[model samples]
Target chain A: MKVGFVTPRYGPEIMGGAESAARMLAEHLQARDGVEVEVFTTCALDHLTWKDELPPGVGELNGVRVRRFPSRAGRSAAFYGLDGRLRLAPREASLQEAERWVQLNGPVVPALVDALTRSDLDVVCFYPYLYYPTVRAIGRVPMPAVLHPAAHDEPALYLPVFGRTFASADALCYHTEAERRLVQQVYPETAATPQLVLGLGVATPPPARRPGGEVLGLGDRPYLVSVGRVDEHKGSVMLARFFAAYKERHPGPLALALVGPVAAEVPAHSDVVVTGVLDEQDKRDVVADALVAVSPSALESFSLVVLEAWTLGVPVMVNGTCGPTREHCEHAGGGLWFTSYEEFEVGLERLLADPGLRRTLGQAGRAYVDRHYRWPVLIDRYLAFLEGVLARGKGRRGSSERADQLARGRRAQALA
Target chain B: MVEERLVAEPEGDHAQELVRRVMAEVHQEAARRRVEGGLQASELAELDELFARHAPVGAKGQRLADVLRHVDARSFVDPVVPVASKKAGGSALKRSIRSATQWYVGFVAHQVSQFAAAVSRALHVVDGELQAIHRELELVAPGPAPVLDLAGTHRVDGWWVAPVLAALDGVPGRVLHGGCGDGWLVEALGQRGCDAYGVDPRVDERTSRVDVRAEDVAEHLRGLAPASLGGVVLSGVLDGMAPAQRHQALEAALAALEEGGLLAIQAATPAAWDRPEAPGEVDLAPGRPLRTVGWEALCRRLEVAAEVREGPAGMDLLVLARARGQGAR
Candidate 1:
């Protein structure tokens, strides 16, 4: 099967979960002998010249074909970056400028229509429905489109336009039960239907080489670590308060390390060691050395960092506010939950004081991840799910005979 | 060693001991019968009186025990007995057996019932205690509610502002409505038209769809994106959270919003009409009314948020969103 994947961003510049997932799906799908995969995404890199010119149509990355379409760079900029005009100077810009930006860049519909019409593909999978290109493109094309609405919140776009695209899609894929419920709640009409719950896979890290590392801030001690974008929603402030309370009760040499992109506004704290965006190896090191890794965010679809921490045999402490995080803890059996500051402090104190508990939880978490979240297992599941969707689509089209012939031809081609 | 010290301890002392033991056994049996006989006699008396009043005159006078045995036998013969004389006869028969058993068994059955009741009550208590422990574990556990992605979207049924506002009045702190799509409810409540602003992750200026990721509500709020809203309205966000994520979302909302602001929330009441095996999709269970015990338990643990009101329509129209030490408005 020749499959086409639609995403907001692609390749070396890809950031965020949906983009990473899209890339992974494309690569894995392409690796299958009887399948061909292509990725379609936005081409504008710099926000300033987004309006200047449309970029080239096609490029190749990691043995997969990637097609880049011209989208309003300024709009993309405003949406992606914090310093975009729409974000920083919303009050200063005139209504006309805003309207102009909306008009010029809002034509993702045309771009998507053009792309779908031009390409001859059997199945098209779109990622992160909130993006204009994916939503607009999927809306126009009537083919067997598989939508991976990465988060429930993104459905705000599809809810108004397609009126629950997941329900109408040939097949819908979700990461967690919590996310699936959110979508169902919004679109109650789609209840009791089979939807694929394909969870994200975690790569098992190589064994930890170093015995331990110094706690960066508290001078020669281990520390509890949190990795994510250092934003308020990620629970950095809540964590800060928790750490402070934890320090007062248990004055151990252990420190608290906050690693990730620091938001513009962070709570003023002395003990926190904020390392802004470390390399992959450094991140793995931090995870390995940390006494515990914490996720304070209340709104995660599924946290990759939590799984990564688990893969590294590091115990996690997740905020009880988010469903996916809690599910991770439960399934992984490697974390603790806290609803209040006092409770958080108590949990942290216990974990910090007892190394044995940490080791047990961490080992359990690693084993759980290895069992359930490996990529090879996930890839096979994905293939089976896609095949089922394709078969169902073919049934709907009343083209079983044609589908069989195509399958035979593809098999023959693979053999050749 | 002392010859003749006991001076003729009774000659037949062993025989007397055997006789006493036999007498004691008889006394115990008599006592047991007395208790059992008393109840059985009263039951028979009642049955006799009832028969005299209700049974046809000159009919064979049947003992209550016999009537009860007939009823038990009839029940197996016809499981779904008609509510006619026949059914009544069967019922009366069962009642007669119960009465006769009470009379014949005496206090044994009563004691057994009492013991069973006590055990049942203890088991219930233990179950409740275990549930409480689990709730505590859930509360103290870190992370947010699990996010359940719904398959579709539905328009909210109606506007519920007064009760929600009343609940918010009790919470003395700033509030944020995570996933405030289109700012409809916020604008309706005069939050957005006034000082309240929304921070959606999507960041679209023209439309209300802010692409705020589920995990990023706190991040946007903390950036002072909405600045300072007196109250946050998380209308349907809670239902979307996993048990853990729900806690995290609640904490994040409380943390980012003003200390004394209100958190006016409206969550779904799981549709009562849903069928069993409702798949892995969204169901009406999450929005059900908080049972008395469940509500109280939640209130006790969530010191920052209190359950101001909850009902069948709106599972919980809570108002107490202010944390302790955050003074009242």
Candidate 2:
């Protein structure tokens, strides 16, 4: 059976959590038997600018088909003006205003939406729900639609318009149970929607015992690594600040390595190193020898880096407010979490001091990853979930048809 | 208050114990620091208050459950209509007309208000029922601490496993044993040439058997494709359930079984449960033993061929039902 994925941006170079998850799912699912995976996305590479970097057209990537449609406009100045007003009181906005809010959060790719409507795919999966492509194109498609909301407890999730977006799906796939709870709590009607908390799969990185400190220029001073785009939303600034404070409290050789593309203004500190963008091999190598892999993002649906670190037998310290990461720590026995600077300082001190605790937690985390997040295990569940969705969709259609028939018969009898 | 050990070396693959230990130590340190004023008490209180306010965003005591509560509390719909207009003597004239038609208008308005109030009440019922269903579904959904944690450590065997296996000997598809903790009975069923799996609300993480799911048995049964299972063995499930839960389990089990399939339930007699030797867990379970006569009546109500067999000296009872091959609607 064939399934299509719809996302605003798509590519290998894109670094957003949801986009990376979509690409990984597409690639892995393509390898599965009796399943064909296709991607319906825009030609954008950068999320912030929404520039049409990649050429638009159907192309093949690793044997899977990709259809990239050029966007109509980039992120506009007017969007920020409107966004500022809406974020203050999103639930109170009028329906028209909500629609405008979605449209203004742009990459407004009409051609991509049109392609999705005209396509004959049996099922369509829309990733990371808060986008023009997903909000506009989800329920409008002819085939059964599955929405992967990847929602957080942010103000945007409380917007009046998302209730309908969530309700329109034939099913939903969530990255974590925390995500599922958050979405359903806001839109309670979705409790009835057929869903699977199918968290994204994590492929085990290649076993390479390369020295990580040398690669990141740390040179054996035990460093804490934060992998991913250095963005304010992902808590890069907060983490950097906390690290500097910790350094002042306990002066030592412990370095902080922010190893990803820099997008946020992380203040320059002597101990904190921002290795602007590394290759995948270098990133893994850096993570492999880290004292602790810190995922500072408070809004992660599923922090993939934590799983990657676990796959390398490294413990993690997460932002306590983020449900998915805290859940990862609790479930895997993999790490600890901190909600404040004080908690962060104390937690970091404990981790830096205890080698035995670190190894035990790290090994537990590895076991947890192996038990659940392997590509084959997650993809098999996903494929089965897709089949279940198809069956449920048929059932819904049959029931609606019967209801239609009954209504028509009643109307005809009244006329007679 | 900081604990000595944060994380213990896991015995083989059981690291959850270590996680618990570590979390304890962390919380302990936080508590000690707060008491000793390393971080000011005022600051800690403010932080705790902030976390407490925002932590349960979509959790219980939140919006979905309370959506209709506003209506419930203020269900009285206003029925007043304006009587004044800005014209010479218009106010007096309108008042006079209103007074003349007051009885009829008031009666009609009251009826309409009551109708609105009734609709709100019905909506409240529907909303409440939906929330209840959501909670029940959540009991089995794949989340952290997925199990319901109601099942106890006291296990029963030796009396019913053989009979259940014999009853379901040649069953031709997947067989499910509900409340199969640690999966001893499921293994016995497997050894008896049946493709059996188990589901228990209390799951042992280190069990090594992937087929044993951590979920509510009734909810698990409901999730299956209709008429899919060849046989069903319900052991140690019904004795502690409320009446509605018991009925739901029975219905789900019967619905899941294919036509001509076997349905077996092994339960203890009330005499055994009420005896002083019994564990008396579940805060005195409400649906204990369901009496042999009640089981027979329940079988009859379900409308399937069945037999009720009392164990030696009336310690337990087994009810076996053969499905008439009905659809799973």
Candidate 3:
């Protein structure tokens, strides 16, 4: 079976949440027999500028062919102004204005749409719903499309354009049940399309030594670690404030290590250390030795860092407001949750004080990862889902024919 | 050592010990204030603290706190006596003043007591009436329906039961012929080695021959027990009900069917009613059949595995077999 992946950006240079997930899946799928995988993406590496870093041509990475198309234009100040105006009152944006907003949102590649419309693959999977590559290109394609919306509760998802994109797909695969519920709440018509909650498979890393206590210039002080992009939206500010308050009350020797891309300013504290974007092995090493890994983000489709920490036999603490992460902790029983500073302090204190409890939670978490997230098992489930999709479309004129009919119905309704 | 161990274990003798101590303290305090005729307000306040601090977890502790705070009965009472003396010169004037004051106090107390009793009775009656109204509203008001566009799924035409009955020729069981319009479908099912009975809103001279009754389909289904029927044939019954009603009827039918029992459903397609040769036998006044996509979505929502067959004659047949160990959803 020939498959195509539609993403805003591709390759190892571009490391975003949905991009990484798509890359991992594309690489793993290429290794399987009887399946030929290709990535159709923009030539841009940076989402900020959407500049054509890579030449507009075909390239090969990890044995999978990739076709890159340069974006027609990058994001603009006018777009930002419009964004601010529309977000104040989301429903006020006109249909034509929303269409223009999709273009100005960047990764606007016309050639990619042309390519997608011309090519007929067995299955074409669109990664993430935020980009023009997905929202615009998806509706134009005639092939059987499976959308990995990676949806969250955001204003953009409610746009009429997105509703049209959701109606055009044959099936949708979500990273978590929370994401699926959000989609259902937003687009009730999607119930006609098949859906599956298949999260990205994490590759099992080989056993590695923990980073020495003195290796990162920390002496004998026990500390908690948070690994992700340090941004206000990602709850870095919240974590910093809570940690400071905890320090003031307890006056402990505990330190907090923040590691990842620094998107927001780190609060200046003697005990808080910000390590921006470490290598994969080094990141794993840091996680292995940490007392507890914290996922403070309240808006995650799936927190890869939490799973990665679990794989290293480290228990995690997640924000209770994050549905996906909290659900993981619930299903795995390998972690705890905190909705406020008081809860955070209590959870951190308990985990830090009790080594036995920490070990029990960590072991449970590792067992969960082994049971549900093994790469081969996940790939098999994906194959089975694909099989189901194919069967549902079989003997009918096409799967999208019904979706198109529904799309037309929606159009009529919109006009009415 | 035993007391310490019990204290460590909250469920042990520590609980009984605490209860005994609280009761002893309460009795001692009550006795210490007996000279004042009744337990003082200060004593009750102290007892409240004791109960709150020593209250065990759960309902017993709550009960203890509530009882201690509301205890109002006193052990002692003041005695009253009538006086009559005729020995002194000013005895008549003093006796007259005392008698008038006593009589006035007694009359006011009696009226106040009577008014309190009346107020209490009125309050009780009002509470009872409010509860009755609440219950009535609960029965009258509808529950929230599932938030899906179920409007289009309830209007299918009913003439398509013929093809469905023709397909169920070899099926065997006690068939519940739902919406047995004019008893034709039930009569057909009777010849197929099945005990067929039907319920419909419209029962006439035709239904006199069979065990058919005039009743709403959803209402009849709701009356049956779980796993009571061998099979259910829903023919044109789902087209004329509201979304919630249709969902309830489907749930009832699924629950009523025995394990491995067959469920044969025939509903009008989107175009069934518009056809020039649409079957004019069954009357579908307010409801229309679900469109193709709408029906598929409804089935998906119901989570029932139905083998759908689209007919060329503006109708669709969905044959389902009840799975074993299927419990109420």
Better by DockQ, candidate 3 or 1: 3
Model 1 C-alpha lDDT per residue in residues A1-416, reported as the tens digit of each score: 87889876677554466778788778877888888888877765432334424365788888899887776433543533422444443434553554444444443435645777478888788887555565456544546777787763321322233333433455567777566556654443222222456667876666655433542434457778899878765677667655765566566566778887777355566667888877676677777888899987765777888888877778888865466777667545677765444345546666677777677677767776675667777777777667655644522212323223323433343474
lDDT of 1 at B267: 52
Better of 1 and 2 by lDDT: 2
Q: Judge candidate 3 at residue B90 and give its lDDT.
A: 60
TM-score of each candidate structure, all chains considered together: 0.49, 0.67, 0.59
Better of 2 and 3 by DockQ: 2
Model 3 global lDDT (CA atoms, 0 to 1): 0.66
lDDT of each: 0.54, 0.72, 0.66
Across residues A74-182, which tens digit of lDDT does each residue of candidate 3 receive? 7765788777777655556776777877888887788898998898677789999888888877766777678999876556766667767777776678787667656
DockQ of each: 0.01, 0.10, 0.02
Best by lDDT: 2
The 10 consecutive residues of candidate 1 chain B with the worst lDDT sum are: B1-10
Candidate No. with top TM-score = 2
lDDT of 1: 0.54
- Lowest summed-lDDT stretch of 10 residues in model 3 chain A? A391-400
